[model samples]
Target: MAGREEQLLAIRIAETLSRAAEAERHYVKIIEGSSSDELEDPNNDDLHDAEELLAHRTRTAFRECQMLAERLHMPDFAKDIRKKLKAYGSDAKLTSLTYSSTAGEQYCPALADAWGFYEPMAAVALGGAVTGLSVLETMLRNTAKIIEQAKTTPDRETQVRDAVFGILDSHSWTRAGKLRLQRALKHTNRT
Candidate 1:
């Protein structure tokens, strides 16, 4: 039935979005880790270049997936029912990920709790289009804060360990994430 078809499409779109989010998160992690020369190596220009390329590719892929999901009219569902609704003409161009939309707000909190990144409420205020960037900045700020706090606190190592693990565990591996991870790991090993 048409309803069933729509439902399936919606599920597909949701899964795709989830995958894209996971990939984006992973790339952010890699970029954050590589950004510090002292933690890594100041002279490793090639590694930095490769990380930048991977981050660019990941962002492009995430945007494409989001656009495709919106274009497919996959998010249309029936009211109060677990069925897909018929797509109106305008559905194709509609995106739930709009800056002012509820869905956009959801990403901020999820990112904060899962990755220990930016404050969700602050990110939501900045708007969704740049939510990813905002979150990244928040993560960097949090990292700097942690370092500063560690200098004054005796439990700095434990706090840093928890923060790192929070990021790693909150991230779900998608196809793109896996590919990037493999490449990064290989590159790391080679160096």
Candidate 2:
């Protein structure tokens, strides 16, 4: 009969394998979605969390596998796996829509001026066609354009405030996102 320690190790391995399989399925779905019509719409609230979720799941699976490798007395292999996973996570994040859009937000005028070049990558990150612009890309591009246009006016701050309020009134952003934007606007106006 197997010892208690052996049984426990087997159980842990089984659980880790199960998790790895699930993560693989998730990754496959994301990849397939990129080429299929089933890709999520840009307005989906889930899109807001996809990048973090993907990275988290991938890291979790790799960590579990690394632990298993260490348990099997393969320290060097485990360390190598850790290094590779870290590098992959960083690379994936840089290409993600969430990262790209958030980075663009930091320089709205430059992003607006270069939007055409950015749109295709944004679409691909959303699991859509590389040739088409995702709705999220369109929205970000429009928002940047608004900021850029406001920059040309004498009363630029007021114009930006009005434009932001107008968007809040007219668009259909997720409630949480909209609320966050509203709070940011109010906070900035106060300072």
> Would you estimate the TM-scores of all the predictions?
0.24, 0.34
- Tens digits of per-residue lDDT, candidate 1, 67-114, equal 333433433311211111112112222111123275433222222222
For model 2, how does the per-residue alpha-carbon lDDT over 1-191 read when each residue is reduced to its tens digit?
23344335445544544544454445434644563444556644443344445455445546655654565556786686677566554625422332237554221121121233223222323332221235435645687676665464535666665665566567665778767766766796799
Q: Where does candidate 1 stray beyond 4 Å?
A: 36-191
Taken over the whole model, the C-alpha lDDT of each candidate is 0.40, 0.48
Listed per model in order, the count of residue pairs whose N, CA or C atoms clash below 3 Å is: 0, 0
Instruction: Give me the overall lDDT of model 2.
Output: 0.48
Candidate 1, run of 10 with poorest lDDT: 80-89
